[model samples]
Structures are given as C-alpha cells and as structure tokens.
Target: MKDSLEVLPGIELSVIHFHSERFTMHHELFSDVLEVNYCHRGRIGWDMRDGSSVFLGAGDLEIHTMDCCADSTITLPLGGYEGITVLFDMEVLEDHVPELLKDAGLNGRALLKKLCPGQTPLSLPASPEISGIFSCLFEVPQKLLPSYYRIKMLELLLYLEQLKPSHVNRLTSYQSELTVLIREIHDFITADLSKRFTIEELSKKYLINTTTLKKIFKAVYEKPIAAYMKEYRIRQAMLLLSQTDDSMADIAGQVGYVNQGKFTQAFKEQTQMLPTEYRKRCRLRKMEKE
Candidate 1:
C-alpha cells in the first residue's frame, strides 16, 4: 500500500491512498474533490467543523465533497488502517448514466445524507458495496473499470436509503442509537456553525437528556460533543480565511469564538499554525498552483 498522499490528477477522477503514522492534514477547500474512504483496518476520525468527530472503523466507508474548510482529517495508519481512498467527479454519473441519480434521487446532497450521513458511516457489512462501486468509478485498480463500480455504488445507495431513521429497527444496538444521536449533533453544528452553543442548549433542542447525550455521544464518536463543536468551528474558520476576504474578527465571531485571542489559540491548537500564518501560506500555495 502507498505510504503517502497519492493524487491521480485526471479531468474527471482522482484517487488517494494513505498508510502510515498518525498525521492530520488541513485541507483549505479548493479541491472540488469528493472522497470515499474505505477503512480496511485501524481507527480513523474525521474532525468535521460541525464538532462531533466522525469515527470510521475497519469496515466503514465515508463520502463527502471537499470545499473550502471541509476537512479535519486524521490519517493514522499505525492504529490499524490500510485501505483505499477513492476520489471521483460529481458529474461522473450524469455524464455516464444521465438518469441513474435522477431516477433514484441519489445525488449525495439531496439524497445520500438524508439516507446516510457520516453520522452512521457505511458500516462494515455495508461498505463493500460502496467501495466496490467507488473503485469501479475511479478505475484505480484499472481492472474492471467504471462499469462494475457504477453497479456497486447504485446497489449500495439503495441499501443506504433503506437504513434511514424511520426505517431503522429497534433491535439495532445501543451503539447504533449513539451513532444516530451523533448525527443529530452534527446537524445542529452544521446548521449554526457560528453561534454560541451549550450542552444544555443542545440537549434541549434535540430533546435528549444531557447526561445520556454525553455518554452516548462520546462513546460512539470518541470526542466530547462540545469539543467537537469547537474544533469544527476552527476548521471552518480556516476555510473561510482561504476562500473569503472576511476579516479575522468577523471570521472569529462567525465560527463561535467570542474573542480574537481565544480564536487564535484554538486555531493554533487544532492546526499547529496561527490563523494569519495559515492564511498567508494558503495564499502563497494558491498563487503557485494557479
């Protein structure tokens, strides 16, 4: 397996594979890439800007678009991870099979998340179907090509749609319940990424008991919900810096940091670089790439 960031730069497809020590990469949007991560081994976490970290275990597969500030990624291979990261263009289905997504309402934004958010990543048993489809789409292995992958992706999405909340069975384990709760937390964070939020407020709004919420949330997502929210806010702030001309103060307030100093501190802690420095670096990188 490749031990570095592998970028397959194609007009319509890209694939990356990471295997090694635990490292966090800060992606300041810019790449209109959508990633599907197949965690074959080890524990991985996506520290999204919406707080609650999304945890992917041995068999979990996650898909989401990459835009400015949409990453808080931890690629830790030592912790038992070795797998494939497939990147595909959003238009693939449209160009190849115009009616596939339209007929099934399968575009991620409109359909998938309503069906399966990072809240409950495609679980192990459910992963092969998505992974196979993604692999086929990207043609990474260059064996079966896109045909097989399309078949797999569509089949997986159909299965995913059936796993939604209303259709979920009560016999599903407590961990499953916690996973559902975590999604609710992410929903809250993403909806109001900049507001002041408290545990009590979160519980009241979601109609959950605070203690039970914390217990289950941390148990499933592996980070306190409050901490998740703060980290996510910082990540979003980074994205805003790279993509917008928003001032530091406004940016701080927008991502829920009440004070400039505190925002800077939080930003530094999560990203290892101060906000100004990060912005400068991003600008230089953007200029060089463009």
Candidate 2:
C-alpha cells in the first residue's frame, strides 16, 4: 500500500508498504525529482547498472534522483518492505521556495545537489537524530497529519544540511556475482526448513569462502545465517499454525526443532506466545470471521 500526501508544493511524502520478491521501478515518470527513502522495517536491495547491489535495512536512509533508479529492479530479499519516501521536484521547489523555508534560509535544490552530487544514491545508517525525526512520522493524529508532515519535513532537511561528509556512510555494494550466489544459497537453505546448514558446511558446498559467505548473506538477508533461519522457521511455523491441524511436536520438527521444549521457547521468543496459544488465537479469529 502507498499513501501519498503533498505536504508542500512540489514536495510529496509517501508511506510505502510492499510485499513481494521484486519489482521494476518506472522512474521515468519522475525524471526531475529527488527521492529520499527511509526504511522503517525489512530490507530493500537495488540492482545498480554497474553489476553491483545496494541494500537498505531498518532505520537506513537512501537519497537519489529519479534517473538513478530508472528501470532499476528493486528486490526485497526478505519478501517484504515498509518505508517512507519524500519526493522533491527540483524545478518546482527551486521556483517557489516556501516562505517558511526561505525564513530558515533553506534551499531544496541546493540540499538535493549536496546530498546526491552524483548519479549513484547516497545511503546512510540512521543517526539518533534522524531516527527521532522519522519515528514520529509513523504515528500522527489524522487531523494533524498534514501539518505534522510539513514540520517534520522541514526539520529533516535542516538536519541533513548540517551533516558533514564524514558523517555519511561509505556506500557498500555487493558484486552481482556474489549476490546471485547468495540468492541461490538462500533458496537452497530455505527449500527445506527441516534441514539445518552450518556456515562451514555451506561454504564447502558452495565453493565460497566462509567469511565471504557470511558477509554477503548478511548483506542480502539483513541477518546472520542462523538468526535469519530462526526467524524464517518461526514465520513458516506461524503459517502452519494458522492453517493446519498438525500437532505442536510435528510442527516443531517440520521447522527443524527436534525438541518440543526448544521449539516452544523459540516460538515464544519471536511471538511472545507459545505455539499452542498462537494456534488458539488464530482459530478464534477464523471462527469470528466465519
């Protein structure tokens, strides 16, 4: 779902929530626009033209011109993403600088140039100041949303203008070859949740160095192998819980947990409820709908 609001002339704010593996961006429509994206949850990977990939995880920010993402394929390695994007139409913004911004001596065009400087996007980890600004955007009273967005947008631009070059994160890109291998590895590992694979074992099997495997895997999946798999297993367990009548022990074993006690503990850790409780809740909801 995408919800857009024009907070100011030529300045639009959009809340984006997508669930899918990949999608191609039609950036041609917004050629002269500057886009600022903040990932609130999940991960997004951009397949750049230079045979490399850039990823953004929770609390990360990416700024770029629309041209930079033209025809680019965005991949959600985790199959889902939620974020906010603020688009600046450089021409309109430059032509009519808002009175509030003029009073503060803020120039939207200058800020875009400063942040972008090149065709490649600028991605940075969220500093505390940035986090504090964006967190408030997620929850605002409906009546005050427009005014709230205007204030926060202005605050964000001012804060960004003060950022030094050193404060920017060095853009990290994973080679296309490694990204492909990592995807293959992901499929292999997740193809059967009942089996567990160690880093060393996968390293030997895939002919990639263990360190490289772990680094690239984490970059693509946003978590180390074990942690990613643990979350994946639990999520799959959730689906089975909601849809099937399998015994708890059977569900645990299907997701690679041989011990019922360990499975229950992991389930509680991820969902804050035991497996049986979760299943009961699902059933109750289904019955209510019926």
Candidate 3:
C-alpha cells in the first residue's frame, strides 16, 4: 500500500517515543478520514510520489486525507524520529460536528491541505492555545472523557475558523462569472441527481472547456464530479434503506438505478456491505449501545 497509519502502545502516556526502527513504516489509507501527526523531534523525510521530499522535524504538524491515496515512504534518521498520531473516523466527525457545519466544513479541511502541505511528516506545536486543545481532543476518547471531548472538539473548530483564508484582492469579472457557473452547476446536480450528464454538457452550459470545469469543481469541492455523484447516490440509498419503508428495488430506482441488481451491486461496492446487511447492522449496533 502507498499509505498507512500506526499508533504505538503507550504513545499517549509518554511525552516522547522512538520510531526510528519503524523508519520505513508507511501509513494505510482510511477513506474520508483525517490523520493528524505531531512531531516531537528530528527530521523524518517523506519521499512523495511526486518526486519531492518533505522534511519534517520537531514541532512540525501535518494532516493528510485518506480517501484518494498515493505511495510515500517515511525515513526516520539514525537518531530516531518521534511523533504522535491521531486518527479521526470520518463518520465520527460528521456525527459530532455542529449542526451548522454538519454539511460542508465551515472553512473545509481541504484548506488545511493547501496551507500545511507538509513536505515532511511532522506535527510541530500549533499555538499553545490550540496545542493544549488538540492534546485534550486526542486523549479524550482514549480516556473515556466524553464531556471534555466535546469541549476539545469545539476548541478545534474555533481554532480552525481562526485560520480562515483572507481575500487578497478584489474579484475580477472573470472570477465573478466563474463563481456563478459553480453555483449553477451545484444547483443543477442537486436538482437532477438521478439523471446522468457528462462534462461535455457542463462545458457547453458554462461556455468553458471540460478541463476548466473539472479543475474548478475539484478546487471548490475536492472531488471529481462522478465520484461525488456516486457518493451522493450511495448516501441517499443508505438513508432510504434505514429510515423509509421503501423496498430495495424502489429505493434503487429512486436513486437513479434502473436495474435493481445493478443498484444492489453498486451499493455493495461502495460500502463494502449489502444494503440489507448494512441496515440490519446499523440497527444492531445502535441497539447494542442502548
């Protein structure tokens, strides 16, 4: 695998840990999840697939997305490199997020990728204020501290909002028009999700080429059009399966699947579980907790 994440035992209790022996350790990908790392000392190099080396040392922080992945290797110097890793499950984040931000991230985690494109794997200290908050959040679940966990999560959100990007200059007419096109495209998909459309139609509608449209969509949404559409369909199917009386065949048709068999297959492929199995599992898990 190109990427992976590992946490050592007692890493949380200890102030520092030796990881040089794991020098070549590569982290695995967990789709839609966020991996946060903090470096305590010494540089660890990442030989990125892009042929660039990111050098991370003590006090450097890094965040990576787990959905789309690539191969990279971590090099711990002979002296040994030390760091802490925090893995946040994507579903947990959605469940815990504030209602206002339950949809799109207030500022979006994608901005974090742009700002901290760590050429290296490291988590240097953030502002002491945030460092304290992050430390609390990282340890909360481990300690079974739910109240403190919620507070820490709120603090993290506040800190993230403080990092919001500032507008550098006035918007040009071209930029304005591009913004309009983005809104139109978003609306078009939201309204006609069950229907299929291509980039060609998008290009013609916006009077721009396919490449530009794709670029803009990715920049704003951090996903390819088709991938997002599939995700949307899967989400809709999951909801219908769990909450409504709709049969699998009816649900499939509602979510743009003309073939009941094909819908079932696609749903399984995306979630790694059949719709019936998932619904049952969801209820079972909930029941077990209660």
Candidate 4:
C-alpha cells in the first residue's frame, strides 16, 4: 500500500493505492467541508450513520458534504484500488471563486451551504468530458500540480454551475445498486490478467445476462470490460517497466502479451511513447531524485 498526501493553503489532495489488503476506516467529521473523490481503480464504500451507503467503483466520481459531527465507516477493496481525493474548505471557495459566488447570488460560504446542506452527498452526472478532466489531473507533471489544481478547480466549478438543477437532483437519487456483484466481477477479471474470458463464459460464471453485465460493468468501471482489461494489462506492463529490469519481451509476456511487437504498439498507443523511452525516463527521474 502506498499513499501520498499534499496540502495547500485551503485544500488537501490525497492519492492512495491499496494492493490486496482489506483496509477499514471509521471517519467522524468535525467540520463542514466539501470533498471530491475520483476512483481511479477498484472500489470503495461508505456506510453512513443514517444507514444509507454509497459505493464508488473504478472511474466513478462522487462528492461529499462532511457536515459537522457526521460519521461513516469506510470499506476498502481487497484486490487493489487507487483513488484521488480533494478536500475544499468552504472559506477557500469563498475567497477564491468570487465570480461563481456572484452568479449564484450568494457568498462562498452561503453557496457551499446551499449546494450541499451537509445532509446527503451528491453524485454528479458523469460524462466523457468530466472523466477526461480527471485523467489529466493524474498525468500532469509534479511541478505543475499546484497551478493545474487551481485551473481545474475553476473548471469544475464552471461545469457544476452549468448542470441543470433537475438533472443534479435526479443524479443524486441514482445509486449503483448492484455494487457487490460488480465488485465480484471486477475481482475475477483482475485476479488473473493473463487469462482472457469470453462474454458468454463470464455471463455463465456470474449468472448475469450478458447485456446487463456489459451495461452495468461499463457504468461502474467507466469503460467496456474488454477495454478495461486491456488497460489493466498495459498498466501492469508500465509498472514492470519502471520497477523491474526485465527485457521488453519478458515484461510483455508477464502482462499476457505474447508478441513484443503488438505490445509495443499498444504501449505507444496508450502512452504515446515506446517502452524503452518510458523506462529511460523513469530511470532519469529516479536518478534526479537520488
């Protein structure tokens, strides 16, 4: 498990990775604040004090209003999971985004209070546009993170303001009801990356209709199962590139790619660079840090 936390004047960002470990968390909030969370990989769930629960899967995003004295128990996945969280102080929003406040006819604190009354959390409508923004946040170079964060903050606010009230309300009411089943499917798929399963086989094994499986899988994982699997393999390859001294062919095979040429092509397509170049850059970065 690895976790990094970065703190700025009015906000905090945490990028967390858990590998095959069951992590339990009990959180009791002492203040009113807004939290934006993006699930990059795997799943997480929160059991609220009110008896309601919210689960976030890979590529799913959600917001929270940590009303004073609110509490929840969090369940983390056992296979692996990665997530990013940003906490915003109400005063920070008030001091930084005056234009947004003016348009909403309230000051920052007032607007924050209105958007989330600290009762129930809201799940914003997900789109390619929103997902792409979240992806970019991770790829930005470390040196540019602070400025990039500020820019993304404003962009997020602008996008939020444009969301229709009715739509936002409806989305808040929508929950991924079959979270347990989806997580089971995810665990199976990720358990062995080298093994590829057919849709029919998966449907039979899971006892779910093929069409329903595909739809819910996409909704939860934010991509088709096949696409997600391919990306998962590529991600495994990426880690090997940075952390191992294996040859390209060996690394490719480890991640289920039998053909080095094909693996190179996919690597370039996903990262826009060759595997050797990526390894070299990683080494250089390590040397610089050392």
lDDT of each: 0.58, 0.85, 0.56, 0.68
Give the higher-lDDT candidate: 2 or 4: 2
**Where in model 1 is the C-alpha error above 4 Å?**
1-55, 58-172, 175-178
**Candidate No. with top lDDT:** 2
Per-residue CA lDDT of model 4 for 67-86, tens digit only, reads 52165545564356787777
List TM-scores for all candidates, in order.
Answer: 0.45, 0.87, 0.42, 0.54
lDDT per residue for candidate 2 within 43-102, as digits (tens), equals 998876556678898888887878777777788998999999998887887777777678
Instruction: Please identify model 2 stretches exceeding 4 Å from their true place.
Output: 29-31, 103-110, 259-265
lDDT per residue (tens digit) for residues 84-112 in model 1:
56554445433543345457655544443
lDDT at position 39, candidate 1:
62
For candidate 4, what is the lDDT?
A: 0.68
Q: Which residue pairs clash in candidate 1?
A: 29-67, 29-68, 41-80, 41-81, 42-80, 49-232, 51-228, 51-229
The TM-score of predicted model 1 comes to: 0.45
Residue-by-residue lDDT tens digits, candidate 3, 1-290: 11222221111122345554223334565444555555555544444443444444555555555432246555453236665555545455544556644454543445345433442222233356546764544345545654554455555555545553342221111233453465478668757556877889878877888987887565334367888778778988898887887788888888888888989899999999999998898788779989
* Rank list by lDDT: 2, 4, 1, 3
Worst-scoring 10-residue span by lDDT in model 3 = 5-14
Angstrom error of the Cα, residue 68, model 4: value is: 15
**Could you tell me the lDDT of residue 35 within candidate 4?**
77
Report the number of clashing residue pairs per model.
8, 0, 16, 0
